[model samples]
Target chain A: MIDEKGILFILSGPSGVGKGTVRKALFEQDTNLKYSISMTTRTKREGGEQEGVDYFYRSHEQFEQMIHEKKMLEYAKYVGNYYGTPRQYVDEMIEKGHDVFLEIEVQGALQVKENFPQGVFIFLIPPSLEELKNRIVERGTETEDLIINRLKEARNEIEMMDKYDYVVVNDNIEDAVRKVQSIVQSEHCKRSRVAKQYKALLEVDDK
Target chain B: MIDEKGILFILSGPSGVGKGTVRKALFEQDTNLKYSISMTTRTKREGGEQEGVDYFYRSHEQFEQMIHEKKMLEYAKYVGNYYGTPRQYVDEMIEKGHDVFLEIEVQGALQVKENFPQGVFIFLIPPSLEELKNRIVERGTETEDLIINRLKEARNEIEMMDKYDYVVVNDNIEDAVRKVQSIVQSEHCKRSRVAKQYKALLEVDDK
Candidate 1:
């Protein structure tokens, strides 16, 4: 076995960028990928998602303790709920050679960038603002005012593209997924990351 | 149409490392890629390859004048023949939105790196030194002494892998080709290159 360390991919985009759909498609294509389940302080409703699968449900006091202990990779308070990625599972998955994908908001993503600078940060976007607005309307799940809010939020998020390492335009879901997958594969071959592998190979004697 | 600027990929490896086969396979897969045609001062043999397609034949004086004018991206003298990549065609191709793949030796690749610092430099290598020597001997195209010399040259080249941006191990030709192609695709999506596109998208006014 190569025992290669798995890459941590931080994926973030605005609300109407179709990031969730693209991420689902990518996971379907690559079995070696593991999605990072976040930790949240929200209440678990009846017949709601599973605890470890969807998220690690935590009490407000516990979440605060985690923050104080510096266990969260990135955290943010949204709508009075504390949401963040815990570092333990991510560390375990990477050690076992499973690439971990963390989907987060821009603020939380930047927080992760500060904590783990080695992670590859990718920002997904629509081809244009007009297309983004159209996608939001086509979803048929939000009110007109909410749609406008999302569009404004997306505009602001797009300005942070320079902070990320790669940008994937979500013009087509399949194409975007393929581009993200390629980025993961190629990042593994970067010289800075694979210098140890090269050294091991070169150290072998030749007769 | 997206007027995307082309990327220059500089590939360097020792002789008999299967760079030619990998490059041929990659070109067959991506029609948008352009194989760089080198300029050589050697005399064209009868029933040989076509001009401008295989190599740009030049007189010694013309080649020296090119050296004087600093027109070569990289050049080296071997067996009294001056072989190099001319800058004019590469510049034109890249300007026309064609990604140029320059396959050269290690020294020439370092020269191109000096000349075109923006190009992505990749060092191709065998999986192991034993495999490298085995492949050299298996080729059956050189004498015993030449094979030994080539193996030594390959060992020296492997030490230079640190100077590259990426490294591709040619354990399997198909896999190596896919890795290189993925590197090319992923590099275009890098934030350093796509930030301008994001800026253009964000500049579109929304009401």
Candidate 2:
């Protein structure tokens, strides 16, 4: 049992690429990963969500106070509500050797990267842009106005992939989840992550 | 199906870490891996070895000429025999999109690193120095004089971890193989490896 520092894996992609779907699938598989639930100022839908499970629902003032106190790892304002990852939980989880997984939007993820650049950033993409458009159309939730805008944003979001460490094509949920799982497993094996432990082992041997 | 360039995975470790055993176990699995047999001038064993499969057995003059012509990827002379990996087969296999696996000694692996630094270098370590010494002793093939020498060399080789990209502790055969497999899969998902292809996808989308 080598007690190494845990890694932070941030899974982010363009809108409507099924980040939530993949994240749920990943967590469903009994893994050692801890899904760090984000705190948001958005109104929780009645009976559809639980406090601190779906999200840590906070009032506008409370969310702003976290920003002022520098307690949020990364937060952004969207659609008149504030959403962010709390720094305390992430730090605590990692210090205890549990990997913290964050599913966030593209902008929020970039902000998190600025603060914690070493986090493994995985960019989830659709199989193709045409398929992406199809998915956007198939969802049917967005009326005429928002579909075009979301599709254009998704196109621009593909360019943001340069900031990621790994890219998983969300062709289907199972394959995408497997790729993410592999990335996490592989990150733990990196020499950069575990070199110090081995070096220390040798030092003990020498003594 | 993304037709991407293959990754080169180099597996090397100290003596008695069972590099050959682990490599064989890995190849036995139904993986897409292609093992690149090393070219050596050393005499093939009485019956257990095959030319081209075990090694591309060659003569001292031919091996030396290959070194002179700079065709050898990495080579080192041991016990009066030249053992080296030929650059030609490695190049051809990689060019054809086959992930080439090379099981080499530490010295030869370092030489290969110098020549082709992009290769994923995995250092297979024994569970512990105590275990390593025990393994060397249990083999019982070495006379008293060679035993001490081999143990000291293995100890020194642990310091070579700095030169490697990942280190897999060879506590058991199956776990070591699994770790190596994950590393290869992760390498495939690397952003640097597939960024060009994704960027080209964006270009196509734009057109």
Candidate 3:
């Protein structure tokens, strides 16, 4: 028995693990899922990304205001930008019975988990380090130094996999997508949520 | 990053909740899953059920002797017959990377959970009490009094739904089977297992 209150899913992975691509495929297939778009204080790069759709681009002051108001669920300083999850939109989607997915780095994921203890954490991994390096190099976006830096970061990320609730090895895109879909479907059947629904059904009092 | 040591899933539900029917559908879809056949001291019913397949139908003395030898995982008394899971076969299947499914009553499921705390517990429920009664009545093997008794037992079973790790409502067989399948698949991705695999993959010599 699934509750009206939706489950929160936290997805974390290395840069080359294809989390974004898998998420895109998942969203295209699952209409009920809502992505928790983070508010960032960084300028949107070229390609004409929208303010709200791509990211809720905010000023440093605005981001600071959000933090002071306790509106941010979890926030972090990454590179020169401040990225954070806004609590209101996520809560609204969950209240509307749509599962919310937050795509964040390992540090932000840990923060989200600490705040929302009931959230399900999933760590994505590449099939092998060599494969991960190949995928990163194939992207052609990063320089040699950046690629090496990413590989180092990936090693650090892999070590933090134990903090997650589940891990999906991105050996194949389709298989990884299926594994994530299965994880989300399975989390909905968790006993804490189901027991509450069952208890409510029993308390119907058929007089 | 699923390991060679597969998980054990304990599935429990009332008789008419379609546990066996769903299990059949699951096995048909996923051949990797191995069902744990219980060892019993009861005579095989007249439908030509084979030994070690339907059940390992042993003599009362043999069952008692095995119990004394501590070979059984969890045993129960049912209708003047003894039924229990043999630990060796289940352990072997799990060690060989076959996820094992044990279909048992709530009591047996609880005992298995107590012993193996990490085992995934799934409870199947009918859509409604009326639907459950209809399914039971359709069987035509039981009198009205017996049907009433079964329903009462079902109510008791439902009370223990909280004890399970997951509760899947079997309104639609396909959907229910998909849910259970997802659960078993996702349990393989649990962080504890994945982290250990990740550590092994690091290949750094630990003196």
Candidate 4:
């Protein structure tokens, strides 16, 4: 039987699908889950996000050094900032029994899945394109051009849904969170793990 | 972008996991879902069970005839009686926008998956073996030996968990029903169906 180990959950979605809101709800309700902090080589914007909490902002040279040392699991460039997941910290968290949650874009999600074949990949989708556009407009942080770009990106992202192991539609926050929770709970009962446990138990009887 | 077509759901569980209760709750909430009436060769026991509603009880020769005619999708022998699903009725129900639900054993579920390939298979599990035993005992319909036999069979059935597309742990009735509902809803967003629809929509723009 596979021993009780930490599970890696990858959450990917378009910008306006409420993936962040659902992730926040999941963290608030689930005490055992840990949010993975990505390391980035960029100046922290005016937001008062902490160093080790929100992200591990580093110098570009330092990020390159880590990559050359084979320390980063996966990395990608967005605008001017270089963001990557550090292999060591995630492994340590898993060893300590924390279910790590990686929130990334569709491309990053595919990279993580390739690196860790056992990781659970979940794609969050909006109920409809109209709802997605409305949500993006409600945010009021982007102009019309940015919103349109996001929608175009969303159309492309939805095409990668088959690569994911599960899909959660964000029609309602509570419903989506419950669905993700149930998925994590059910994965623990997979036959590959449970069968081994049962075989060990049966061995005791034979003795 | 997938068209609004009903999907088939196959539910399988051990004898005492309260699948019947969960199914009842699901059907009560979602009137659009069609609970498949299985065809059986067993004689109807005296308890006000209706034919064509509860089950389509047929003679042994008639059941064999259906199987010979390739009308039965999958069949199995249980306690000297044969039970099978009629493909024609299920297909008609799906065409009419009703999701068909087949409640069967793990073996039957596997057979259905192999035959249909498009059917969604879900495995329902108890919270624990002790809870399962307690539920079976509470029924008070069988001898202690029979309960023991059922428990043993449950152990064997659970070993087949990996074969299922999704596993729902039935710790609470309402929660399990909600989980099943979410799974069915999310399945509609699968890329195999959605991507094709989206591609078709984009084709007009390409021209």
Candidate 5:
């Protein structure tokens, strides 16, 4: 890594918080951010998923090997398949002075925090629990039982919000993206991150 | 004060760091912010300054009396004149839910930090010391001796930058304003500040 290391933003939120939409809009507005593509053992769907684009699709054996090798940044099993953020790609992008965004669940985000304590942990939330429930219901992508489970999961997720450094309420799409963008820019200006830049600036002789 | 206290931003930097220009621009862009007007023992300049506009021009006796009453948020003497941020005004603004910006010197800033420890401290700076000296020279408001003294003061001021939370380089005015605005917006999203909001949201039963 250069003297100025890039920031790692761990953005985690409960399901149906519009996090994906917010992140997508954020990327559209600010192309400078780099999203760390996660590795998953889940079978890629037939139609449109591309390798290294949607995800780094790994077989169960390969995924297990990575876990054994301790190459996963943070991993979890869901529906009998493994999902995780890879450690190497994050390191590479960060070393190259790119601010890397890791969109993971709360459990995975917390695990990554242990390994990379410097990451900016942001917990996204809906304007209200009612709104969150409404979004999930409107999607109609899951069964009623699954929806109830998701809402229950959301309540638990909300409890752990205090663990993150910042919280962004995704009430308005552009507003939420602007808030995240502001956080990243202000964070770049933090003394812990900008101290070296000042040191180098001070080294220049006043002629 | 309300359950959700307004954020106090303590902004400080060395002379010739363009802090005033940046702050002015910041106010212009974000009208919601409140500038914490200071009380000074020094006489206000005759030509344009207004009472309670530029400063609350206080006589030495009145300033000393306030200090005796522990009314100043933070105070220091420079060139035999007392300058301080009045505690009452800051509290009033914060209670009213206005994000307050207190611009002061390093000594005064550190003092404010002790009393208002929750305030977000931001230190503005030039990209380089050489640039700082150049700006001082370009102003043409001070003599060569004063300019030299200012640069020396800047060097000493910069040494204490690590004590602050964030540092914004005033290389470009618009960029600096955006960074400060971002900091304010993001600070609002901090869990500590938003916890009560969440509590209220949770109180509402989902039908």
Candidate 6:
């Protein structure tokens, strides 16, 4: 992939589908990918959620300032908290031929698609709708009303997956990670991406 | 891939680019793929090339008859010998959801493209054109004119790679095989191929 612009890989899915777990597993193995840390105005979780590693902690005022300055590639408000991907860092890394990995919610992912239309969008799904419901139910703390609402939201998000380029059935972490890695590998070999390079290299006029 | 029709994977490149070696290496590790052994009118090579294993050797008259009967998927005459893929066997295997792998010449690969346009066409390339010429020259058996002619033929084939879906630089056998395997893995995840199944499975009206 040297001298070629690195591809942007966006992994997104509905809530409670283990996107975070799968993303963690994928990164544990693929050192070649640069994780694009997201900026958030929400409070970071207590357990080892360091700034820049888990999320770039920011004040609401600063988050709005970034939006006003056209700094964010995509942003969404969840529970009155600002969450967005920084544009400059991703653009700089990919320009240096380093593939950038982004794990986000469905809304932010769709927004990112508007800016980086050529980016590879992967939708992670539970094995079945029944499996998704079971996972939500097993969490055990949610009231019946909350559980029903989450399922309804999930159904809506599933419909939006038509916009994605690949779907990884998160039956397990290893398989999901492997499929994602294969997608990255295959995208690098895509004819549309590499054809010009090969043509330029081998189309000698020595005939 | 169960219940889904198998994909045809075509591995092709200019002569002396080592398509055969990479195909062998790929099959040795990935048994999920079924190699579509080609048929030929040429006499089997001396070193243990078995009938139906290496190739289904046929007489010139029989090969022509099969062609006349439209039994061949794609065929080309090489060095006065007719070589072609058996259409019936490949179709049966793919219908049963077994991926068929075909390693073939550039001309014949293009012919197969016309027939199975959905097939994944991967064009293997040498590290450099000079490297391709070096490989041919290192054989040290062909006349200088023959080597020049082969290089010219290779140049033309490389140009035809625009018709392919993927281009793998065969710098070494291992890397080439890995790239091909990745393509198969990723193709199985393509939205055009799997979206309907996912939509049906997840689209519930229980809201």
Winning model by TM-score = 1
Residue-level lDDT of model 5, residues A1-207, one tens digit each, is 126667899888998998889888888888778999989999889999998998999999999999999899899999999989899998998898889998778888889988888899998988888888899999989899999999889888888887888888888999888888888888888888887668557655564
lDDT tens per residue, model 1, B1-207? 246789899888877888888888888888878889999999887886778988999999999999999999999999999999999989999898889998888999989988999999988988877787788888878899998888888877878888899988899989999899889999989999878867785675454
Winner by lDDT: 6
Q: Write the per-residue lDDT of candidate 4 for residues A113-201, one digit (tens) a residue.
A: 77787888888887777778899999899999999898888888887877887777788999888878866766655545454554454
Given the true complex, what DockQ would model 3 score?
A: 0.58
For candidate 5, the share of real interface contacts preserved is 0.74
Interface RMSD of 2: 1.7
Model 5 Cα lDDT, one tens digit per residue, B1-207: 125667899889998888788888888888888999999988879799988889999999999999999899899888999888999998998998888998777888989988888899999988778888889889889999999899888888888888888988888998888888988988887877886677567546554
Best by DockQ: 1
> Which stretch of 10 consecutive residues in model 4 chain A shows the poorest summed lDDT?
A198-207
CA shift of A172, model 3, Å: 0.7
Considering only chain B, report the TM-score of each candidate against the true chain B: 0.94, 0.90, 0.89, 0.87, 0.88, 0.88
lDDT of 2 by residue, A1-207 (tens): 477888899999998899999999999993899999889998899878999898999999999998999899899888999888998889998999999999999999999998889899999988777777788889888887798898789888888989999988899999898889888887887888987897678557755
Please report how far candidate 4 places residue B129 from its true position, in Å.
5.6
**Which parts of model 6 have CA positions greater than 4 angstroms off?**
A42-51, A57-62, A204-207, B42-51, B57-71, B203-207
Model 3 residue B206 lDDT?
A: 23
lDDT tens readout by residue for model 4, B64-170: 99989978878999889999898887998888767898888777887887778788878888767777888999989979999989989888887777677776778
lDDT of each: 0.88, 0.88, 0.85, 0.80, 0.86, 0.89
**Model 1 interface DockQ:** 0.76
Ten consecutive residues with minimal summed lDDT in candidate 2 chain B?
B198-207
State the weakest 10-residue window (summed lDDT) of model 3 chain B.
B198-207
Residue-level lDDT tens digits of model 6 in A10-58 = 9999888999999899888989999998899999897889998888999
Q: Give the worst 10-residue stretch by lDDT in candidate 5 chain B.
A: B198-207
* Total clashing pairs in model 6: 0
Residue-level lDDT tens digits of model 1 in A108-199: 89899988888999999888788888888998999999987888788888888888999988889988988998899899889998877676
Q: How many clashing residue pairs, candidate 5?
A: 0
RMSD (CA, Å), each prediction: 1.7, 2.0, 2.6, 4.4, 2.5, 2.8
